[model samples]
Target chain A: MIEFSNWDILRNLLLAAQWTLLLSIAAFIGGTVVALTLTAMRLTRNVVVMRIVRVYVELFQGTPLLMQMFLCFFGLSMIGYEISAWGAAILSLTLFTSAFLVEIWRGCIDTLPKGQWEASRVLGLNFLQTLRHVILPQATKVAFAPTVGFSVQVVKGTALASVIGFVELTKAGTMLNNATFEPFKVFAFVALIYFALCYPLSLCSKYLEKKYHVAR
Target chain B: MSLVKLDQVHKYYGDFHVLKGIDLNIKVGEVVSIIGKSGSGKSTLLRCINGLEAYQQGGIAVDDKEVTSEDIQVRRLALSVGMIFQSFNLFPHLTVGENIMLAPTIVLKKSKQEAEKTARAMLEKVGLGDKFDRYPEKLSGGQQQRVAIARALAMNPKVLLCDEITSALDPELVGDVLKVLEQLAAEGMTLILVTHEMNFARDVGDRVVFMHQGKVWEEGNSKKLLSEPQTEELKQFIGAVL
Candidate 1:
């Protein structure tokens, strides 16, 4: 039987926290860019482009994040395309984040009145110019609250990456729990850390939601 | 030469005809007011001019260029034909100045500084000089509509298409906006207004177009149309209003 000290457990958990932070940032940035591309593609009149983006959105959204992680981490390895767990986790999270983000942002763009588009067109703006000068500037204000709120979900989602042997907070907690047989304390600490990170974001999101009234 | 000409202009919404075989012409600097009952294609006719609503069968020309094309001419047509709306439809995210400045900066290729100067000049013309930095929501409904008018004017349009510009305004607010339009018309800005205010229409319009059932019911001088409406529909319309 092996015993790990509290100091060792805490150190390992802190180290894992770095990867969690990294993964969240990577996923968010990657998702945002991809989500914007998807949003534009979905809005296009081109049938082929719209269908391809629709399929991409469906594939990512329909599958659970856990299944996506499994496919990226294990399924790829099974086919002899070996990749790091960090890479796998990030890939899965990016896909998951992008799908949800595209839908969320699309909803914001959708809420803008058809009159706004007509108004911009009448002002002599072509498609790109209309989006830049008129539509997006307004839609972005409409998008802000939900987008900030969605970040909390992204933070919580990072925990799932631990299942794929990624050394994040959850994986560290599990290891500590196994050694000390103190599931309650170890898990409680892990939950508290997550709450510490996520609750503020949740509160910030709530504050913005109240401030912006995006739904209203 | 006619500034705008629409020949056999037809528009449909899934077989619900919004505009039916419409034909109209106006020379440069003429002010034409299209008056109609709600859903009688006054707005639709204005929208079709700028290619905002594509007509199924029509040859619509703005400054002698056909709007139904993939060329820069359609974009060029938009540049010439500016349409205002029933709702002010100012970009809520932009300041009054930005709202006016945006088209010039993006579409007309004016530098930001140059565009801002033009925007400020237009806002001043609309009696909103002190409100350059004010957001749309910060302004009153009448003020917002004025900014929308100023925004259209900033494009330096060859023809200004107004769709019920004063319809959503309160009675008191209506006069001020109409005053601005009268001034624009006086300055020879080639105005086409879709309005419900009969007095403003008669006073400011050079020509009056009465629309009914997606067609132009009557067309004549504003004095003739208002004083002695010839058609039964026009007489009934004037009677109902009076």
Candidate 2:
């Protein structure tokens, strides 16, 4: 049996934490692109497209992230679409993050007065022009806090990737636990690291919400 | 020739009839004020001219262009028919100059220099020449409403629709907005206004239309129609608002 020192476990977990941070960043960026495309289709007011997007959102949001990760990692391989655990983890988290962000952004967009749309229409500005000039500038301000807040959830969600054999922060903790037989200390450090990453985001979200609310 | 026309236009939101056979017209450079009770579809009729709301039956035309709620047709109509709302609907993100310049620059495809030239002219026309750089939220209600007028005029529309433009303002602020409308009316700018301000209707409007329960209940010379309303609904509306 190889006995592990406290420094040894901490060092390994910190190295693995890099992968978690990278995964989170990739997922956030990917999620934003997908969510924006989905949001645009949702706004097109085409009934068929809207229904498909709605189902897509419902499918991801209604199911557990764990199941999604498992399906992406294992289900695809069974069907001969061989994907790495890293690929599957990123794909699932991006899908999950976007599903929530689209709905969050929709709420932000809907908060504007209907007169904004009506006024723009009356002025001869087309839909895209109105969105670019009048709607987005305002909606973006309202969306900022909620978007930052949702990033914290994305960061935490990376922990679930461990169940699919993608070695992130939580997987590193588990590996350290097995090597050192010190689950309590190892898991505590893992949780503390997560808090370190997420607490500032929570504070930022609260700060922004207050700032936008006051401006409104 | 009638610059704006709505022929027996009927509109419904599901089963609730909003504008039932509204027949009206405004010749070139005429000012028409529409007054009515709430839910009487006065604003809806004004909205029909700009194709803001589609009518299931009948037709609306502005400057000889067919008006429909279809996107392309409405975009074409918008160049010649401008509508301002009671809320002043000024883009809060933009300065007054930018607000007035938006439609001209984007829809008309004018150069920024040309749009600004027109915007400054419109602002000067509305007595907001000095407020060209102010934000909508930073201005008084009357000042913001003036900016909205400048925005609509920046489109160079043949007909202007004002939907209860002064109803949202403080009593002290109402006069300034009305004064701008009066100046526009005097300049032979064709205007269709849905208003609660009876004095402006009688004083500036060439014709007055009184709508009741989704119909044009009474319409005549502005002073005659308002002073001697033939219908009980018109009498009641006047009583309530005055």
Candidate 3:
């Protein structure tokens, strides 16, 4: 067995963490755009559009995300099309994150009192116009804390990308453990790295919840 | 032409009929008060005039445009009819001035400067000139309701619907709101109100209508309705109020 050096392990984990951060950011921004689109589609009155969004939500929510990543990465390659592991991981995470975000956002919209809708409608705003002016501004306050809290989940979710040949902190830790034959130490270091990234965001989310009472 | 006319208007909430074969006409600048017990479809009638609630079978015309279209003529009718709810329903996210200016700027397509000027003038009229920057939650219930009234009035609607506007206020706060509404009525704003304030109904309403069991039971000048109600239900309602 190779001798494990703590400094080398720390250095590798830190370098790999940059990719984890980048991946999470990529997934979050892409997911927000898609989630907003899904929210609009879900809010529409057309039965066919609503049914399509419902199926999209159910399919993404019901399937295991790890299987989704595997299918997106290797399954696509099997059809004579080669895509990088990074592309596949980002695509899968984007789709998964958006599905969950859309559901969370739709709940925020639904939480709005019926009176606001009636008030805006009486003001002669169409559905989209109402959303842009009245409903969304109020809903944003409700959506804020929970959305920040959900980012913590996304940061943790980056670990699953390691299974698809992506070189994130978790993947790096696995490689380091195999070479050094020290699972406990490597895993503990990996956990610390994640804590360092996630703890501040969790604190910020709690602070927002207190200040805004977003859940209420 | 009368500002509003409803003919054989029928509204239902899953077979529990709310408005049954109702016929009414209100000329411009008329202040009509509808008094009824709770769940007597008084609020429903006010809502139907603005198309806020869909009636199963009816024809409501606001300023002579048919309101029973599939596309729904909300914008045109809304420009002519403004509604104030029991709960103020001010957009909490917006400031008082912003709340008042929103419809003018958006629905009426007025410029920001014009809308803001109109909003400030209206707020001054409502005795809230200094409260323009405040959020709705920062205002008292009466103050917020005044802002709501100001918001609707900025649209320059020909008809104003007040649905139990003072029901949520404290007794002390009710006077201030009624004063503002009284001022609006005195200025010749065509007003339709569903109210529990019997004295205000008798004093301020030009016409008093008693809706009972989903139809207008008795209606005439407020003096006649208050002193000599024709139906047993109206007498019982007035007896309870007095």
Best by DockQ: 2
What DockQ values do the models have?
0.63, 0.83, 0.65
Q: Per-residue CA lDDT of candidate 1, range B1-242, in tens?
A: 89999898999989899999899999888889899888999988887887777789878988877887452555778778888899888887888888898888888899999999998899999999999998888888899999999999898889998888887888889888998999998998898888888998898889999999999889989988899888899889988987
For candidate 3, write residues B132-237 as lDDT tens digits.
9998888899999999999998998889999999999999999999999899989999999999888888898899989998998889999888999888999999
* Candidate 2 residue spans exceeding 4 A from truth: none
Per-residue lDDT of A1-216 in model 2, one digit per residue for the tens? 877888888889999999999999999999999999999999999999999899999999999999999999999999999999999999999999999999999999999999999999988989999999999999999999999999999999999999988899999999888878888999999998999989999999999999988876
* Winning model by TM-score: 2
Which consecutive 10 residues in model 1 chain B have the weakest lDDT in total?
B67-76
Chain A TM-score of each candidate structure, as shown:
0.92, 0.97, 0.95
- Superposed on the true chain A, the predicted chain A of model 1 yields a TM-score of 0.92
Write model 2 residue lDDT over B36-113, tens digit each, in one string: 888999888888788888889998888888888998888888888888899989888899999999888888999999
Give the TM-score (vs. native) of candidate 1.
Answer: 0.93
TM-score of each: 0.93, 0.97, 0.96
Q: What is the lDDT of residue B163 in candidate 2?
A: 91
lDDT of 1 by residue, A1-216 (tens): 777776777777778787878889999998999899899888776899988888998999898899999999999999999988999998999899999999998898889888787777777778888787778877887777788788878888999998989988899899888888988878877887788888887788778777777433
